[model samples]
Target: MRTVAIIGRPNVGKSTLFNRLVGQKLALVDDRPGVTRDRREGEAELGHLSFRIIDTAGLEEAEPGSLSDRMRRQTEAAIDEADLVLFLVDARAGILPADETFAELVRRSGKPVVLLANKAEGRGGMAGAYDAFSLGLGDPVPLSAEHGEGMGDLLEAIEPFLETGEDEDDEDRAGKPLRVAIVGRPNAGKSTLVNRMIGAERLLTGPEAGITRDTISVDWRWRDHPIRLFDTAGLRKRARVEDKLEKLSVADALRAIRFAEVVVVLLDATIPFEKQDLSIVDLIESEGRAIVIGLNKWDLVADRPGLLKELRADAERLLPQVRGAPVVPLSGLAGEGIDRLMGSVVQAAEVWSRRVPTAKLNDWLAAALSAHPPPAVSGRRIKIRYMTQVKARPPHFALFGNQLDALPRAYTRYLVNGLRETFELPGVPIRLSLRSGKNPFEGKKKTWD
Candidate 1:
């Protein structure tokens, strides 16, 4: 994999871009500059290419031998070691003298550079993007790292620099083991369910809350397909977690959810849909992982008539974000409903990875828009010109149109629901990104197809 270092001045959204590419919040981010003091690295994927991405501390001139100076040295070392450099500049802030100085440093390294004009989501940053030509590092790629815009353009820009030929490992990705994480609240029988799944005492289980204080993984085969199971410590309310170790464990559980392709949210059948349970499901949805709600300890529940149907209805009403997710009733200790749960998991994974053809997507978009035309905003009708699935580990789509920033949230939800139903993408989080017209000053009118 090619190594690409993100080199820029302070607060240019390098860490945000890094986290976006890595598909995990591995780096800490804040409004304040200089939040990062060391070089952080992670594997990143863009379209079909995968590479190693390095997030370096903000490049700032400081006193010799000072902390800031050492950080700068580390960044310079990263630039020297990287096969290419992603030079980011705050498009909203425009080009700064510091940016000029840093460009010279990266230019002197003689490495391939992709100038990123970050924060160029709307028209506000376009002027700066045009001014970036003065930096003499080729044309700037307008990007919005926080909103995940311009990623398609970035992928095209860097594809030639990175290796794209598939290797033996890449060939195995289709047959690779599916990763599934079991997460829930404390005393929710997470460990019990994990032990029952693998049919072995691989994890410590008990009635005590917080018995498992770490995220543990187990490898097993189910019905001939390889599977990796991640059993995470039960997550409790943030207010209830005061211990430092518990905090670390919770963070680890969160990371496991982000890494997993499918997440089985194990809920106690006796007390289902607690605030923490809903919050955990929300986290899984936000992370764009396929979801399966496991109603554990079902054998202990007294009510058995129509309770499963009621619970499924409640899941739809309470968690519409992951609407139609499979809800399995099982007793982990008794090993009941394990097959059904695994079946749901495998199906959810397939749906999460599903992709729709652009022709079909646009056909659906036209019908949906015609059925319920977008409401006029400020007396002008919002025209949705095009729609296409950009990538699908969670089925993210891009919608191009005029006045898209003014598109109402309710309307977007309607379109998301339509896509879900029309394409049969149930239970998986569907990402719909809106891309508005370019800066009007470019002497070109926005065209619709």
Candidate 2:
């Protein structure tokens, strides 16, 4: 796919535009300027054109020795890599010196530049739109990225530049399934375990730690489900990491976590309840991905019965975010319990991908609310009227109710726990959002009346 870079000064709605084009929140947006420090790439489609859109850091001429200089370098690198550049300027602020400087930089690159005068919604942007032509890039495309206005003109400008014809192997590319990352701390047997599961010498196996440097994603199939398995470098504490490659490897693992649908966090059986392990679990949960825990090198541990009880307790105590998650014990080197591990993965993934019907979900909600009524606030009883599964990769629900503003966190947990138990959803993160208001149809007269 052709690469299109969105370049602009800070707070110019570049990310907002990027997200609108990509149809996903791949980049974080906030009122704060320069929230984007890294170059984010996502697949975007405009009419019949599909391309990779890169959201780059805002370009600023910083002093020779400064962080902004580093940011400038990153932006320049993105500009170098892009096939087309969308030079964004704030229409509300008019043409600033930074805009002029960046316009020159874009010109120097000798690439096709589309000057976008963003925030051109009101009369305030009229003068800026007129002033933008002086930059000599081209007639500015007046756009309000936040409101999604003037997209037709933007598409019209780029349509001519788009390379014609589709690839012959488009079906194969479209059919590629999700890539999963399996990661954990040292001696977690991540590599050995992966080798065992693939039934090959896919990765090096040893008693030593930190054998994997680069994050290696191996493409394979399980139960006819196509998967690219990423075996990442074992993450050590930041203080203990001294090598540059290890730092890069750690970043690569994090990138993998961001991209993957399912992340298997392998744990060492000997010291499974470490703070670092908990941190990894928190990261996966925060990323809103499906997770499964594997207690590896289990053959080395003694007191199997007692250990199982303790492990369950630890999982409950430390990782309540993913309650009722499946924890399987396996020795990667010996190929023990490998089938159960794969089965758990498939089961967890199915649950993660599950979408509860609106009727069935409301039914579940009614029973749950009846069992444990919501707490009253200021003598007014809160009533949950309806519930709907808004979206799911790991299922997310939106609850509409009366006086739900006063709904207690404990009650929310109760509903979530009930939903998990009732639906048999295990080892996947679930989200519940509460919205309070009167039912729109409540005041309406019946047709018979």
Candidate 3:
């Protein structure tokens, strides 16, 4: 598929156009300049044409090795990879020196450029749109990305460059990439593990614990299988997270976990099973995300045998919620056991997406009921009429029965464990919802009051 990159100086609505093209707010947009420091991408469609669109950071002139300079380099990389460039400018702000500088750079690249005069909703921006001809890119396509106007002309401008053949990305058509979120408490080497897994320094890592602030996603292929990985900020205790920015970062990380198909909780080998680490696992289980535990920094362990045994015991005793989750020892730094970790991820994903046939489910339900029937509530036998899977992906089941709300938590755990064992589900959270069945004799009159 062809790629289009949105580029311009700060606060020119570059991200707005990118989001409009993608039909979703994949990029974070704020009135503040430089809210977007990293490039994000999404597949977009325009009329009968489709392409992969990139949202790059606002261009800025900075000295080499500076943060601003780093952002510029990322934008340049995006431009280099793009088949076309959507150069956006705020029509209301008119032309600036910075815009001219970046326009020169875009012209130098010699890629097909569509100069977009965004914020041209009214006559307020008409003069700037007219002045855009001075940039020497082309006739500016006066557009209002915020109000969703002038899309037809914009589409016509770029449609000529698109290849008319069908999209050749087979992986996208066959199935969606597995969405995995690598999460843990601060400094568990989550970013490093991602870098090692992709065999590239795609993420910025340092000795700092909370370097990653946003939930950044990247497309990667592992063993020819496409994987979309979200690298998130390290979560600290809520009380310890005092800064407002850190709070927002934590919130973003939680969103990633909620949307992820599988979550790998990276644990520091020396401090495996810390209170925070346990809490992170508990959160993943509660969210019903398929989970795998990667004990990172295995190279640092002095007594591997003793520590591994202790860790296994702790997982059994403490993480009963996900009883049989895979706990693979690995060193994210040394890349040891990374392959095993990926295998565990694949296995967990299969279990997470498992769907049980209704016939087999009822059969297992009967056997489970016969083995250990639900105890009576208030001396009345709680009759469970039937059970059926409601959905998969950390499978959810709905059990119809009498007085289900009064059923003991222990009984629910029994059914969950039975379902897990009988269905061969491991390392994935199971949800069993109790729903009261309607009484058949409800409409009948009560003769004796």
Candidate 4:
């Protein structure tokens, strides 16, 4: 991965800027100087640009054996490893002696740099931003990372230093790894499952609840496909999450789920489908994510004939929103049935990202309308004119028709269900929206041929 390092002196809002760029608060931020002591790295994006970003400790002049000296060493190490450096300055503070010193150091390294004048949001910092010209590190990208101003200029400045008009990972690769998050209530074997899949005890796991206070990610190849897996903290009722740290952890987990292409709602097979579990699944579906249900701790189950079948039925009856979502039973500790769980995950992702061609979609719609024509309202039947998929990654469609405002909800459900069955889009939510364009000859042409 191409590396972009954010470098500056202490308390110049480097950590805050890093969090803003990454779109997540992965690094701790404080008003105090030297709050960040270690090098933190995350995937970052600036408009169309995506790269690995490193956040380094602040640079300072310190005694040879002092902690400040060690922090300076870490900053130097980050600069050495960086392909591009974002030399950040506090525009409100103007050009200081330390800014000039760091500018000289960056100049000596001969690395490409995008000078950022942070905290230059309003007229307050304009003069200092102009003063940055004396540092001789190229024209500064004057902006505030806090309020996110001047990002367009920043992206323009950094574009020339990036990987030539392509994302770092998307240059001619056949398929991108499926980003999946496995989330559940606390003590649902989330960490244990991650440890088993990686074939190592990388994550701390035990019988204790709430051991994982953050969302941790790992990459692995499974069944000839790349999988980027995120193991998240178990979510509980918001009323129960009084602790500040747990609240942060929960927020972090929610961010993971939003970024994920697919999500596995891991459930304790022993106590499956608690109220919280259903709510979590509701949240995933509401986010328009592909979902798979894993029945963890299956080894302890005293299996009865038709028990698994009945359980799947319950999933349908309970989760009518994601009515046909896959529910796979597995033991994360024993590594049993993992292949099945992965298979379901892959299948769900495929379905989630599946797009039907416009021609095929119209054909399916015609057939569906023929099979079940719209019911008459009073004396007139609603006219359905055109149907096409406007987006994928959850498969949203727009239907241009007349009298849609008066159409019943049951009829809309019929169309949605018909699309699901006709396209074989099982385990994926189908969105069908009704639109009216006021075509002059609306009912004359009932279908798109």
Best by lDDT: 1
lDDT of 1 by residue, 296-336 (tens): 99998846798988999999999999888999999998999
How far residue 245's Cα lies from its native spot in candidate 3, in Å, is: 1.3
Error of 3 at 202 (Å): 1.9
Ranking by TM-score: 1, 4, 2, 3
Q: Which parts of model 3 are misplaced by more than 4 Å?
A: 1-172, 440-449
Query: Against the unseen true structure, what C-alpha lDDT does each candidate score?
Result: 0.89, 0.82, 0.86, 0.84
Against the correct fold, how does model 4 do in TM-score? 0.63
Ranking of all candidate structures by their lDDT, best first: 1, 3, 4, 2
Candidate 1 is scored at a TM of 0.71
> Candidate 4: how large is its RMSD?
14.5
Question: Model 2 segments beyond 4 Å from truth?
Answer: 2-12, 15-50, 54-175, 238-244, 438-449
The prediction achieving the highest TM-score against the true structure is 1
| Model 4: per-residue Cα lDDT over 273-305, one tens digit each | 899999999888766788999999988884656
Reference-based TM-score of each model:
0.71, 0.63, 0.63, 0.63
- Candidate 3 lDDT over residue span 286-350, tens digit each: 66789999999999994656888788889989998998899999998899998899899988999
For lDDT, candidate 1 versus 3, the one ahead is: 1
